[model samples]
Target: MHFLRYQWEPYLSYGQLFEFEKNKVVYHQGEAGRGIYYLKNGEIKVTLLSDKGDERIINMVPPGMLFGEHGIHGEPYLTSGTTTCPSLVYYFSDDVIATICRKHPEAAGIYTDSLIYKFRTLAEIIAHLDSPVEQQMAFYLLKLVQENGNASMNQTAFAKYIGTSRITVNKIIQKWKQKGYIELHKREIIIMNFDKIRAIASNPHMD
Candidate 1:
């Protein structure tokens, strides 16, 4: 959960800062990769649009993360990025980023590390595709807590993010509530038994 915070302000001086309202689309799939973005604050959802117009939630980018790196290669963006809340994002043109990296080679490591982390996460997701729903939900809930300090996503959104039906998510959540593993608030879910949740997440086969 720890992120390396590079001294990027000086190198990113040429970058433009833009504020986006909640649910605002920063970029769309198939758009020319103009530049990568640095998220100064707030959350962003990266999604992929299928040929049949089906949209899948890829991952959520938290503050201080670098996204839209596909723009660096000058190809079309494979996924669309949208703000989940009011957000401050810095847009760095591809050429400018290249120049900065050329002049400051160390800066390139930051992006490299970020990209590696993203790829690792994607791999983990793929590996867990056939995992029990409870285990996947537990893992995702822990991830949300780590990133946002709580599980704030609603059941519908949570289900979509985990690639499961809302009914399935609701059933597991209700069971957790009855078992005193979590507490459901008006808008958030609080983990009451972190150890138990972690155990389930790590070993789904355990009772």
Candidate 2:
């Protein structure tokens, strides 16, 4: 959900603000999460570190979204958050959230919605986990385009996000470009045909 319709900004007034530089590690995985975070500006990438020491990009938090919700209420963070660019973020500790909820009961509902969104993200991850690389790539491409109008991504980041090699991502992107499914430029991908991408994203003929 976009930040405007989500209506969680007012509640963030009680949060502590922090600035982050590009590529900064906001929080590490398995750490006791002090609180949830709201992105006031720039971008944050949430990732999971596998036992094999690979970093898998899971969620990209843009401006005006709540992230790190999975780590609230004394739970350890399930993943790590790092800034993809310079960022302004608001941190809300459990006590702070409790105070807001007590003063404004509606805040609780927003938290619930945020958790629901988190669950949806997790479901998407699981759904794509076993899919072929092309399908996985298409699904995320379509989803990002639908969410942000166009996807600002490089092949390397896309490869890391989808757990593949950069060369593999480049090949698929080139094929899609030839088919007019997308227009690929440096660090950006513009969809030429959403329906066609959506079709391939759902098509699973691989053996």
Candidate 3:
């Protein structure tokens, strides 16, 4: 949080900002913005749309995490991010960002680190593409369970994260459910078996 405050205080000086409601688009995939975001509250889903109009969730944006970092790449915005709840976002223009970097080179490194980790995650996905969908889904469910504090996990959200449709997720969830591996009620998904799930995720190869 301290790192964010260090990076954020400078942007506040510019005073350009916007707020968004649940499911509202903060920016589209190809729009331009000069500043990064400091998420004060709520959550956002970073996503991309297929040519066929399907949504692919890339990541969940939690509080205190930065988004719209394509400013570093000189693009307007790389992908669209929408809120899951009402959100407060600070928008800083390019001029404002430049001023901040001038004063704090370390802040630039922090931003670069964030982007690099994303790229590394993409690399890992490519390497794991050959893995079975069941393992892939299991791996992702475990991640959500951890990230969301094992709270309610919506099947649609899981499907989006796995880059598949909800129906596919439902089918896979059904298999797990029958095996007493999970419990699903409405939008809630509860993992009942951790060892088996982890073993599936730990498979050295994507079978």
Candidate 4:
């Protein structure tokens, strides 16, 4: 869920801005996607409810990115989004999108690309759903590091992202620490050996 926001920021002048407090629900899974959202500031955790009723944080939308895009074609949202902290957001209603497309034809291609990105993301998640916990953790940890330079989240939150418990997450973090694969600094998990972590992410090598 990273995007080059500057490309669409000017056009969003036609959209409405909203402010949300920490932990507020932005949108719920299974609900109609009214329009897409662009994060102007703050963090939103985009989580999906698993078949077994567990919440898995799929992506963390940082400032200057769009989310709630799965709402294309009036379809229901495949995931739920909530504010990770007090933040500023923009709500681009369906009408707003069409209006922008009419005036700025290039914007249409970006929207199409967003849909493709969403599909590819869901496919990747499906492929990893049945993997072992460690494999799953490595996968997301690598993803986070790639997205934000480091995993800027606590173990408990990381557990939720991996659809596991905090204790289990802690155990793996400890194991990685023992191997000098990562270091816990405040809330961030800094990867020391990107190759090793990337290797584990690609295959179930942690066992």
What tens-digit string does per-residue lDDT give for candidate 1 at 76-173? 88788999899999998878888889988988888788777666766777677688889999988898788667787789888876787989999999
Alpha carbon lDDT at 128, candidate 3 = 56
lDDT of 1 at 206: 64
Model 4 per-residue lDDT at 134: 87
Clashing pairs in 4: none
Residue-pair clashes per candidate: 0, 0, 3, 0
lDDT of 2 by residue, 1-207 (tens): 664333778887799999999999888899988888888998988898888999888877778788888778788998899999999989999999889999999888888888788778878987788889999998888777666566888888999889999999999999889988889677889988877888888894531
TM-score head-to-head 1 vs 2, winner: 2
Instruction: Give candidate 1 misplaced runs (Cα > 4 Å).
Output: 5-10, 50-54
Q: What is the lDDT of residue 103 in candidate 3?
A: 83
Q: Distance (Å) between predicted and true CA of 161, model 1?
A: 0.9
Q: What 10-residue stretch in candidate 1 is worst by lDDT?
A: 1-10
lDDT of each: 0.82, 0.84, 0.70, 0.84
Candidate 1: clashing residue pairs, number: 0
Worst 10 residues of 2 by lDDT: 1-10
Query: Model 4, 8: alpha-carbon shift in Å?
Result: 1.9
